[model samples]
Target: MTTANNANNNLSPWQPGQSGNPSGRPKGTRDLIGYVLETTDGGKELIDALLFIVRGVTPNVVVQKGTRPRKGQQVRPADQLKAIEMLLDRGFGRSPQQLDIAHNVSSRPLEHLSDEMLKLLVESARQLKEGIGGGYW
Candidate 1:
């Protein structure tokens, strides 16, 4: 179709990691986190969960009026994930049975699912974002 051709023509010069302008962020500086899932369903679920937390509550965002945005709290995703896992382990005895039991019935033990997990859940709500395609930012 002519429309498809026009789209391709518009995109022809813009290859991945290519800039028409020579100056940019430079190589290896940009950190892009992409998820590889075993199944589409698994991928979707992960994406959904991430989206949910991001949209619902962004703990890092400090509401300020008429001022430039402040630097966000610096924490690597891997570190955050590890902290969450550790907290879950500490709170609910690192076992499938424990997790299942906690989920099936509310208990004081499950209250300790780590602040990080709660933050992630709030920041990334399970809904597609506008313009950025799918998943939470």
Candidate 2:
């Protein structure tokens, strides 16, 4: 059995009043892209444009494929199904998958039956086995 050292395992353990990752990013620090965007003057405008695109504040226009004119056609509003899937995965997690079951089954022994009954039981068992391409008794 392999024993791992928790302190040296690289993940920061919880402390009483401190965040788990004290050595990592500070509390108010944004990610690199976010920081860059927030710092830039045109970032707000760019973000507004993206928001408009996502929220359909403005219409979606895509060019029609395989045409000489290739004129722009207005598309339907975007569905946020991927966002829902991401949120569901992060919040409640995914569900366990069901297993496929084989149809093979077994029956009890015929030792307690009478001699005639035992003969009939054997014959019936044989027929059942043959019907299902046979398996062990």
Candidate 3:
């Protein structure tokens, strides 16, 4: 059985919003993962390999078909998923996710809503976000 590890919170005396060392690592600073990757021997090679796989340059990686399964073909779940995604993305195209009200309004005629109505909608949305509204979702 593994023992539970306790954090030494009392080690740093600094309170909230106060730092012991102010001139620490600046904002937008990346961690050692990137640095390690850059310094390591097979890092570039690994990246190139990953890119090659993603780009579908390597012959025997995943599904060969861009569309969904037909006839009596041996189906790999991962490949099948990719095929479905590829088919939809390339053919019908992926639709943008809307907040509650889905579908493109541009295609359908929209009535000009009043300022009060707009405000109410915004307030309702805010309430939904804050979990104040009766969340059906």
- Candidate achieving the largest lDDT: 3
lDDT of 1 by residue, 1-137 (tens): 69989888776566897768878666644432232454336456544444433344223322375553345544456645755665567558875431122354244464777899767645555433442224433
- For each of the candidates, the C-alpha root-mean-square deviation to the true structure, in angstroms, is 22.8, 16.8, 13.9
Q: Report residue 125 deviation for candidate 2 (angstroms).
A: 72
Ranking by TM-score: 2, 3, 1
Worst 10 residues of 3 by lDDT: 1-10
Segments in model 2 whose C-alpha atoms lie over 4 Å from true places = 1-19, 26-35, 38-42, 51-75, 79-137
- Prediction-by-prediction clash tally: 16, 0, 0
Output the number of the TM-score-best candidate.
2
Candidate 1 residue runs with Cα over 4 Å from true position: 1-73, 96-137
Tens digit of lDDT per residue, candidate 3, span 42-93? 3655444344434544423333556533444444556545655655675588
Off by over 4 Å in 3: 1-31, 40-47, 57-96, 102-118, 122-137
lDDT of 2: 0.53
Error of 1 at 10 (Å): 81
